[model samples]
Target: MYTQTEIIKDTTINGSEGELVINVGPQHPATHGVLHLVITLNGETIKKIEPHLGYIHRSIEKMCESLTYRQFIYVTSRMDYLSSHINNEACALCVEKGLQIEVPARAKVIRVLMGELTRIASHELWLGAMAMDLGAFTPFFYTFREREMINEIMEDTCGARLTMNYMVAGGVAMDLHPDFQRKVKLFVTQFKKRVPEFDDLITNNIIFQNRMKGVGVLSGEDAISYGCTGPVARGSGVSSDIRKLYPYDGYDAVAFDEVLETAGDSYARYLVRLREMHQSIRIIEQLIDAIPEGDFQAKTKAVLKLPKGEFYTRVETARGELGVYIVSEGGTTPYRIKFRSPGFSNLSALHHMAKGSKIGDLMATMGTLDLVIPDIDR
Candidate 1:
């Protein structure tokens, strides 16, 4: 058997029927993280793509079993760092469900607003990175210009940009910053005008369109079969938006369409995320000015303990649906914890989508899936 180092260094491994096996990542820039793929190819055509995970696994679930309920929630922020706010919300919601905590309306609205902002910020980064994967570098800078605004807002309110750790078991850690509304409104106004430029720069570009449009087509049935959620499923016209189907944290009160595209290709996924960013802006506009006055955090004991039971909560992260499961034994810390992260499920479909496709097209296919490596490895 070939050693791991040799496998990675060798460009090709001899396979049956003269097929060639190659490794795509673990350090490839296109992956956006430490993701490894063993691909079998016949010349430029891909025959199979096998994802080799665990390069960055931290055994987060096992670690959570040791930390108290209050502390474990923050660990999830590292899983999907791009959707850190939403990941924390999912864990907090699960804890609240077990404790029967009724979060204050003001806190609920704040949580939802933060979640939407996180969604937009995550999508902005994905768009830029996706463009860069396809050999366009200019859009990356353009997208970051708007994303930096959201980062500043997050930093000002939550004291951190990427992994905010702001959401808690009862509610958010604190109230919004005094200038939260004005800054959010400013972001909304500027984003609305600038979003169209995204289309002009990359979305409508003939070369980019050709690279993405029909590549990596996945049918709606296939998407569901692979347990894909978020844009990956919605791009195939799957109605899997957890916010719409199972609203939480004042999501029910907000008015926004569940963006969908039926084409089920790379372009369709691209359009789904692009449109969803607009919907996130809409959710923010509805809640930013309407935040009610009340305590930002609910009352809870300092030493929190959950009743013996199993609890689960699901949230729509920027990548897809993130489900948190906890098994409590009437203790301060969890007996067990498991995360049904979307990246792992979505990544499972890569082989199905990229089979028989050219190696050059793999970047577009994988880029649209938007797999966050830690999210999968965790």
Candidate 2:
């Protein structure tokens, strides 16, 4: 590892006595993905933490400036692959705003449904991975089983599972599959029936509580200042849900509670996501009943061209607020594109929470943070 002396310090946890510092990650599973942290500790208590990034930069932003608007949307899917649908929604909204087009009501409903499903899938993967990081492996399989079914649905409808570029500027790339409603209904029903068992299997277990509760606690005020959002911020009692702040599509019409927990620890984050899955399933239940009726795509010129101005759009992604900024010069290609990725913002809070914590707690903390590396690198 390359160390810059300017950013280095004798990190120590002072308890009116002594301290300790330990190196963690760059390879540790708990760090989530190539996240290296130089942690200062004092007998299992964290004192200071410094995170080193840029281990996976692909320069997706600079690359997007060269691609046409239509082609650029595909790159977003790679940013947060687990919640690619939400990333796709953000980019599509930006393009739609720039192009001055309206997505049909049906398209909006479908987009909402897809985005919620992606949220559920992302949470499920996190739940399983978090459990695994804490030394439980079986739950990973159970979570994967449920997530796999959702992926199959996405694959059948959007023709891709993880990187589903389902949304386009005007509307959806294609209509929902003929059996999308039935499939989603089945998944929702099964998920509702199976989700409760997760609580018994992990949340209520004595071991998990012993490992998590009160660990890496972040107060609501600190969470906001650190740029935490989605389940992480919600767990800290901060209501930073973009859906509530700015309803992009049919989110305003939906009836659902913004899940929140005041604990702001690893346990709180876990519980928030667990309940969030149920809420997402709830949203899907109401939408699946009526798929609505409309054209899958809107009419457009031979080549898509945005107005000579700047447009920005944000969406409540599973990670957090994902914003797409685009400046058009009345051309087929975007002059500049910037993605304010949620994971990047969420990752910023790691150092804040990691200071004065144990190395084991680092795993619990980072896993609860639910970071996706591509989103950070992008």
Which candidate ranks first by lDDT, i.e. highest? 1
Tens digits of per-residue lDDT, candidate 1, 264-342, equal 9999999999999999998888888789999999999999999999999999999999999999999999999999999
Model 2 lDDT per residue over 61-158, tens place: 88888888889889889888898988988988898887778888888898999999999999989989989999999999999999999999999999
Model 1, global lDDT: 0.93
Best-performing candidate as measured by TM-score? 1
Lowest lDDT sum, 10 consecutive residues, model 1, at 7-16
Error (Å) of candidate 2 at residue 8 is 9.3
- Cand. 1 TM to true fold: 0.97
- Name model 2 segments beyond 4 Å from true: 1-21
- In candidate 1, position 32 carries an lDDT of 91
Candidates' C-alpha lDDT: 0.93, 0.85
Q: Number of clashing pairs, model 2?
A: 3
lDDT of 1 at 187: 95
